[model samples]
Target: MAWTKYQLFLAGLMLTTGSLNTLSAKWADTFSAEGCHGDKEHEFSHPFVQAVGMFLGEFSCLLVFHLLLCHDRRRPVPTVNPGQSFNPLLFLAPAMCDMTATSIMYVALSMTSASSFQMLRGAVIIFTGLLSVAFLGRRLKPSQWAGILITILGLIVVGMADFINLSGREEHRLSDIITGDLLIIMAQVIVAVQMVLEEKFVYKHDVHPLKAVGTEGLFGFTVLSLLLIPFYFIPVGEFTGNPRNVLEDALDAFCQIGQKPLIMLALLGNTVSIAFFNFAGISVTKEISATTRMVLDSLRTLVIWAVSLAVGWEQFMGLQVLGFLVLLSGTALYNGLHRPLLARIPCCAAWVLDDAEEQASAAERERLLANNRVVQAGDDA
Candidate 1:
C-alpha cells in the first residue's frame, strides 16, 4: 500500500523522536553540576532520575489518550470501546520490566557513546526472536536464523571496534565502554521479556494502544519513583562521584538538575520526545506494516550515529560502519524483507517458502501485526 502524507509524517516523527530519546539522555549525562553535599562538581549520572523523566513522558500519553477518547466519543461511532474492561494492575509486571531495562540502558548510556548505545539496541531483535521460540512456541524460518547469526557477528564487530580505539592511557575508559555495551545487551533480554509479557497477557484483552502505553507509564513511574527513596540509602562502589556515595542519590540528582539548565532541557526533551515517539510508532504500525516500522527503526540508528559524529561525540570508525551495514542487513533479512533477493539465489532458494508456507507466514505476520498495533508503543520498555 502506498503511504499517505499523514502516514509519512508519522514515520518521520517516529524517527526523529526516537533518536532524541537516546540522544537527550546521553546529553544530560555529559554535564557537570554541583553536588548535593558540597560545592564540588560531579557529572550528571542520574540514570534513575532520567528514567523517571522517561516515565513521566510516557504518563503524558495518558493525557493524550483521554483527549483522543473524548474526541472519539463525540463521533457517531466511537473508536474506543468504553465497555472494555481489564484491571489496570495487569500492567504491573511489564512496567517493572520497563523500569529495569530503561534504567540500566540509561546507566549504560552514561558510560558509552550515543552512537554505540543506539546501534547496540538492535540486539533486542535477537533476544526477542529467541524468547519467542522458547516461551511462545514459535518456530523460526531459516532466513530468520541467518539474520540472528549475522546480527551476533555485527555486535562482536562493533564491540571490537570500540576496543581497538582504546589507548593504553585510556584503559579505564575502555573498561567503561565494554561494560556499558554488555549491560545494554543484557537489558535487551529484559526488554524481550516485556514484549512477550505484553503479547501474552495485555494484548489479549484488545486494549487500546494509547491506554496500554499510558497505563504502563503510570505504573512504571509510580513504582520507580518510590524505589528512588530506597536507592538513596543503598551504597555502590562505582558511581560514587555523587554526594552520598550511594547507588542513586535522588537528592543529588535533583540538585544537579536544578543547577544545570542544559541538563534540565535535555531531560525535558527526553521526556517529551518519548511520548511523541510512542504515538508515531503506534500510528506507523496501524497505517503501514510492521516491516516498515522495523525499517524506520534501523534508519533511526543511522540518524543517531550520524548526528553523534556531526556533533563530535565520537570519532568515526570504518569498522563500526561495516558493522552497522551488517546489522541492517540482518534486521531486514530477519523480517523477511529480503525474500526477493533470497529467491534470486540458486542454492538459497529453498529458504524462500513455497505457496503453502508463504500463506501461513503471511497470516501469522498479520496476526502479529494486529497485536503489534496494540503493544508496539508500550514496548518502548
Candidate 2:
C-alpha cells in the first residue's frame, strides 16, 4: 500500500527517535566505560549526576527551541501554556517516577554492559501492557496477547542468558551483576507507571509533549537535587562494587566534570542527546500511540547492541542474539506488522480472517445506523 503523508511523517519521527536514543546510549556508555573512555575520564560514574545533567539538558532544549524556533505562532509545533493546561504540581509525581527510573538505569549501566542494559529494557513493553490492562481497563486483542506471550518468552531467554553468564563468574562479581540486572528491571517498572500516568492524565489535558517533558525536567531536577543534599552530608548508600560513598562521590563527580575535558564533553553530549531523544519519545506517544513508541524503541536496542559489540564493551553471545530477535519479532507483531505475512500461512490465517470479518460487521452496523437515521428524519418531516 502507498504510504500516506501522515505515515511518512511518523516514519521520519520513528527514525529520529531510534537514532537519537541509540546515540544517547552510546554516549552514556562512553562517558562511564573505563576501557573506552580515554585517559581523561572522570568520577561521573554516579547515575545521579547523569540524571541531573539530562534534566538540565531537557529544560534547556525546550527553552532554546521555544525562543529560537517557536516564536512564529503560525508554525506547527506543540506550544505549551502551562498556566491554562494543567496544574504544575500534577507533574511532580510522574517526574519523581522518571527520576527514580532514570537514575537506577544509569547505575545499572555502570554495573552491567551496555548491550545487557539495552536488552533488559525490552521488558518495559511487557510491563506497560500488563499495567494498561489492570489500571487503565484496556482489553487486549488476541494478537496483542500473543505478542505479550512471545515477549515474556523472550524475557525468559534473556534472563537465562544472564544466569548462564553469571555462573562462570566469581561469587562476589556474580552477585553484583544480578543486583544490577534487578535494578534495571525495577527501573522498567517505574517507567511503565510513568508512561501509563502520562497517557491517562497528561495526554488528556492536551499538554504538548514538549511542555510536558519540560515540566517533568523541571520537577525532576529540583526534587533530585534537593534529595541529594542529605547525600552530600551523610552516606545514605554505596554503589555495591564501586567505592562510591554518596557524599564523596557526588563531590568527586562535580570536580571531575570541571577537570576533565572529555568527561565534560561527554556529559554535555549525553545531556543534549537525552533531551532530544526524550522529547521525540513523548512526541511519538502523543502523535501516534504509546504502543508504537515502545515498538520503535526496540530499534534503539539494536543500535546499542551493535555499538556495544563494535566498541568491545560486550562480546558476542548466542543467547543474547536469540533473545534480541525474539523480542524484536514480538514487538513488531504487536504493532500489526505480522498480519500480512501470517495471513499467507494456513495455520495463522484464521486470526486474520476473523479480524476482517469483525471489521466488516462493524462497517455494516454503521451503515444501518446511518440509513435508520435518514428514514427517521423523513418520517419526522
Candidate 3:
C-alpha cells in the first residue's frame, strides 16, 4: 500500500524525537554546572537525576491520554471494554524495571559516545526474544533465531571497536567504554523483563498504550523521585561532582541546571522529546507495520551518529558502521522484510521467493489470530 502523508509525518516524528532523546541527554552531560561548593563548575554526572527527567517526560503522556479519553467519552460508542480493566498497581513492577534500565542507560551514555549508546539499544531485541521464549512460552521462528545470532555478532563487533578505541581518542579510558557497553547490555536485560511483564500482565487488561505508558511513567517517576533523596546521601566514588561526593546530588544537579541555561534546555528537550517519541512510536505501529517502526529506529540511529560526529562528540569508526549494517540486516531478516526485497535479486531470487511463498501461505491465518495480541502486547518489545 502507498504510504499516507500522516504516516510519513509520524515516522519523521519518531525518528526526530528518538534521536533527540539520546542526543539531548548526551548533550546535557557535556556541560559543566556549578556544584554546591560554588568554588568551580563540575561536569554534569547525574544519571539518577536524568532518569527522573525521563520519567517526568513519560508522565506528560498521561495528560494527552486523558485529553483523548475525554474526547472518546463524548463519542457515540465507548472505546473501553468494561471487563478489561486492570489494577493500576500492577504497573509498579514494570515501572521499577524501566527505572533501573533507564538509569543504567543514562550512566552508560555518560561514559560512552551517543552513537554507540543508540546502536547498543538494539541489544533489547536479543534479550526480548530470549525472555519471551523463557517466560512467555513463545517460540521463535528459525529466521528470528538467525537474526539473534547475527545481532550478537554485530554487538561484538561494535564492542570490539570501542574496546580497541579504533579512533584512538584518549578522552575516555578503555575501561569506561567497555563498562559503558556492558552496562547498556545489562540494562537491556531489565528492559526485556519489562517488555515481558507488560505483554503478560498489562496487555491482558486491554489497556490503552498511551495510558499504560503514562501509568508506568507515573509509578516510575514517583518512586525514583523519592529515591533521589537517599541517593543524595549515599556517597559514591564515581559521579561524584558534588560537595558531598554522593551517588546523586539532587541539590547540585538543580544548582547546575539553574546556573547553566544549556543544561536546563537539554533536560527540557529530553523530557519533551521522550513524550513525543513514545507517542509517535506507538502511532506508527498502529498506522503502519511494526517493521516500519523498526526501520525508522535504525534510521534514527544513523541520524544520531551523524549528529554526534558533526558535533565532535565522537570520532568516526569504520567497524561501527559495519556493525550497524549487520545489525540492521539482522532486524530486517527477523521481521521477514528482507524476503520481498531479496526476491528481486537474480542470484537469491529462488531461495527468497520460496521462503516468501511459504510465509505467505500462512500469513492470513496468523494475521487474523495474532494481529491484535502481537500488535497490542508486543510492539513495545
Candidate 4:
C-alpha cells in the first residue's frame, strides 16, 4: 500500500526529531564526560563552567550563522538595500537575554539535580505565553490560560517531589537547593522574555532566523568575554595558586583543557549541538505552527528526562513521573485545544476579513474598467 503524503511527512519529521534528540544526548554526554562540570579541586565550579560553555556555545552558534548566511546567498537574495543590512546591535538583545538565562540555569543546575532542572524549566512556557501577550501584543485565549495553569500545577508537583527527596537526603542543604530553584525559575522568565522579543523584532523583520541567532551569539560571546576579563582580575584565591579547595581544583582542571583531547571533543560536541539545536528549532518553526512546536518541545523535554533516568544520569521517582505527566498533559491541552479555540477570535477573524477585502477591491477595479469601456463605445456610436 502506498503511504499518503501526510504519512510520508510524518515519517520524515519523526526521523529528523529522533536524530536531533540523539545528537543532543551525545552532546550532553560529551560535556559530562569531559569534566565540563569542572573539577572538584578548582575554584571555578558551576558558574564558571556555565559561563565558559556558554561563551564557546555562542561562538559556535555564530559560526553556524555564517554557514546559514552563505547558503542563503546561493538562493535568490532578498531585495535588501545597501543600508538595509541587519543591525548587529538590534539582534544582540535576544542573545544577551539567552546567555544570561542559560548562565543562571547552569549555576542552578550545579546546586540542584537534573530532575529538578527539567521540571523547573516548564515554567518557561507559562512565562513565554504571558510575555507574548504583554510584549508582542499577542492575546491568549481562555483555553491557553487553562493550559498555562495546568502546566504550573504540574511544575509545582515536580517541585514538591524534589522537596520530598531533599528532605530524605542528609548531605543536601535545603536552603541552597531552594535558592537554586528560585534562580532556575528566574532563568525561565528571562528565556520567555527573550523568545517574545525575538518573535517581535527579529522574526517579524523577516530576518533570516539563523542570521539573527548568529548575531545574538556573537554579541553574547563578546559581552561575556569582556565580563570574564574583569572576573579574572577578581582575586579569587584559587587563581593565586593556593590549590587546597574544590574551586581551586576546578580552575586548575579547566586550565588543563588545553592538553586534554577529551575536553576538546566535549567542547566540539557541545558547539555542534548548539548549532544543530538552533537550526532545527528555526526550521521547525517554519514547518509547524508555534503551538504545535511548543507541544513537541515539551515532549522533547520528557524524552530527555526519560533518557537521563535510563542512563543513570538522573534518579527517577514516582512523583517525578507524575509531575512529568501533568506537565505534558498541560502542554498538550494548551497547544491542542486552547490555542486553536482562541485563534478563532479577533486574530484569525481579522486575517480572513482582510483577505475578503482585498478580493473585493480587485473585483471593483475590474467592474470600473468594464464600465469605462462601455462609456467609450457609446461615445463612438
Candidate 5:
C-alpha cells in the first residue's frame, strides 16, 4: 500500500513536468495574445522567440543533468566508452528533427487553442505504429490495429471540429487555422520519426537517455542560432514591415516584460518548464515504460484542456470532448491497457482478454521449462 521513495520521486517529477508543460502553453498563448509588460497588446508576434527559447532551455537543462551525473560516482551507461556507445555525429538527425518540430509547434500554438494544439499531438501514437511496421518490420496485434483505426477516427473528428469552428467565425482565416493545425500534425509526424530512429539506433548504441538529449540539445541550439541570423532580418510581424534587427523582437518582448511583471515571471516559468518537460519526459520513459510515458503525455493534454478552459482561452465543445474520448480509448487499447481491465470484467473476460492471457502464459511456461532443463544439465554434471 505504500510507495517507495523512488516511486514518489518519479511521481513528483511527472506531476511537475505535466503541470509545467500545460502552463507553458497557457503562458505562451496568454502573453502573445493578451499583451505583455502592461501593454494591452503584444508589440510583436514571435513564435520564433519561443523556438529560440526551446534550444536554450533544453541546453540549460542538459548542463544541469550532466553536472548532477558528474557529482554521482555511478558511471553513465553511454559514458562508459563514449566512442563505442554514442557517436556525436549521429546526433545530427534527431537534433535537426527536434528543431523543426519545436519551431512548428510553437508557431502552431500561437495560431490554435491550447486544447486543440495538445489534442492534435495524439496523432503521434498512430504515426509511431505505422513507422515501426514499415521500417522495423514489427507486426501489430488485432487490438493494436483496432486502436490505430480508432485513433485515426479521433484525429478526423478533432480536425473537423476545429474546421467547423473556424468557418463559423468572421474574422478567422480558414487558411491560417487549417495551416496551423496541419503544422501541428506535421510536427507530430516528425516527432514520431525522431522517436523511432532513436529507439532503433540510440538504444542499440547504448546511449544514455540524458546524454543523447544533451547532445541533441547542443546541436539543436547551434543550428537554431545559425538560423536566427536570417530570421533577424525579417520584418517583425505585419505592423510597420520594418526589418527585425538582431534581438529586435526579443528586445520588444523584454521591454514589454518590464511593463508587466507577471509577463516576465510567466516568461521565466515557460523557460524553466520547457526544460523540465524534456527532463521529466526522458525520466518517465527510462523509469517506467514508453507506453506509460505515452499515457502520461495524454494526461498532460487533459491538463492543458482544463487550464485553457479555466483561463477562458477556450470554451467546451461537445465534439472536442467526444474526440478526446476516442483518442484516449485508442491510446489505451494500443498500449494494452484494456486487456487487464477487460479480463477483470466477468463477461468480457473470456471474449477480450483470454487470447492474450493464453499467449502470455504459454510463452512464460516455455521460458521456465527451458531454464529448468539447463538446471538439470548442471546437476547431472
Candidate 6:
C-alpha cells in the first residue's frame, strides 16, 4: 500500500515512542544507581562492555539508516552527491563536535546523579534556541524567547530542589557534582553548535539528512574509539596498584551490566525508539514545519517524564512536577502563540497554493460570464 507522508510519520512516531518509553523504564534504576556510585576502578575492569555498548548504540543507529535506505531505495533519500569520492574532511567538523559533546555527557553522567542529569539536560533547549538565532540567523519572536526563558526557569527550580536535598550531605561530594554539571552544560553547548552546523551543511549542500547522520555517526564512533584507546591502557598502578583491587574493580564493572536487566532493557529500548522517532520526525518535518515538529518533540519529552515518574524511576516531587508543567506550558505557548503568527506571512508552496486556488476560482467565474454574453448575443442576432 502506498503510504501518505502522514501515515509514515505516525508509524515512525509510534515505533519510536513505544521503544523509548520501554527503554526509559528499563534504564531508570540502573542509571540511577550507576550515576550515583560508578568510579574509575569499576570502569577499568569492564572497559570492553562500556566500549561495546557505545559501539552498539552508534552501530544500531547506522543500521536503522541502512534499513531506511533499503526500504526507500527506489528513490534515494535526498543528499549531496560527493561525486564518486569519499570526503573524510567533510565529516571532520560534525564528527568532532558530536564526539566531544557525547564524551563529556557520558563522563558527566558517571560523575553526577541521574536526577541531575535529567533536569540539567533541559538546558539544551535554551542553548539550541540561542544557537539558532546567532549562528543560523533565525529570528525568534518575543513569545518564543519567553518560552525559552520559562524552560530555563523551570530547570533552575528543579535544580534548586536537588541542591536542597544534597545540602549537608557529606556523602555527596559537591565538587564532583559541580564538575559533572559543568561538563553536561559544555556538552549541551557543543551539541547546539553541531546541530546548527549540520543544518547549514544539509541545506547548503543538499545533503540527505539520513546520509549525513550516518556519516556523522561513523565519524563519531571512530573518533571516540580512538580517543578512548589510551584510557584503556593506563597502568593500573598509577590509579590504584593492588592487583586484587584492580581485578575486583573489573569484576564489579562487569557485574554492573548483569545487576540490572530492567535498566539495560530500558537503555536498549531508548536506543531503538530514538532511531525510529528521528526517522518519523524527519518525515513529518518534510510535510509540516520544523516549529511544529519541535512542539511535538517537546510533548514527547513530557511523555517521557510522565512515564519515568509513573514507573518510579523518579519520585513525584512537587517542584519537579511543577517544573515539568512549566516547561510543557512554555512549549505550548511557543507553538500556539508564536508559530501560527509566523505561518501567516507569505513564503512557502503551501501558502502559495492557497493564493492560487483563490485566483483560479475567480478566473472560472469570469470565463462563465463571457460564455453567457456570447449566448445572449446569438439570441439577439
Q: Distance (Å) between predicted and true CA of 320, model 3? A: 1.0
- Least well predicted 10-residue stretch by lDDT in candidate 6: 40-49
| Candidate 3 residue spans exceeding 4 A from truth | 75-83, 166-172, 342-381
- What is the per-residue lDDT of model 5 for residues 1-381, given as tens digits with 9 covering 90 to 100? 565687557656776666665467457556533333444554334565667666777778668765776665375553433334447878788788888998888777777778888888888888899999998877788888999999999988888888877776765466666877899999999998998888776665656566777778788888887776676666545432113433335555555556566765655676677677777777767666676677777887787788788978877888998889999998888888887688888998887766777778877996899689889989999
| lDDT digits (tens) for residues 330-380 of candidate 1 | 888788898767678887677665833876988899799978876976787
Residue 380 Cα positional deviation in candidate 5, in Å, after optimal superposition: 35
Off by over 4 Å in 2: 1-43, 68-70, 74-84, 236-244, 279-295, 342-381
lDDT of each: 0.88, 0.71, 0.88, 0.63, 0.73, 0.58
- For model 3 the TM-score comes to 0.88
Q: TM-score-based ranking, best first? A: 1, 3, 5, 2, 4, 6
Pick by lDDT: 3 or 4, better one: 3
Q: Per-residue lDDT tens digits of candidate 6, residues 78-107?
A: 452332334546767977787777656655
Model with the higher TM-score, candidate 1 or 6: 1
Q: lDDT per residue, candidate 2, 1-381, as tens digits?
A: 565687557656655655544345445445532312233443346567777877886676558546644465565864644334478777888888999898888877777767778778877877888999999987677777888788778877877777787787788767766777889888999999999988777765656566777888889888888877775666546553124444425555655555555766666766777676776676667767776677677777777778777867667789988998888877776667777788999998998889879878977996899689889989999
Better of 5 and 6 by TM-score: 5
Better of 4 and 6 by TM-score: 4
Candidate of highest TM-score: 1
lDDT at 297, model 1: 89
Residue pairs that clash (backbone atoms under 3 angstroms), model 6: 23-266, 26-263, 45-250, 78-208, 79-208, 80-207
**Model 3 over residues 265-305: C-alpha lDDT tens digits?**
99999999999999999999999988888899899999999
Q: Give all candidate RMSDs, comma-separated.
A: 5.5, 6.8, 5.0, 9.4, 6.5, 12.2
What are the runs in model 4 whose C-alpha is more than 4 Å off?
A: 1-46, 58-62, 68-84, 171-174, 233-253, 256-261, 288-292, 337-381
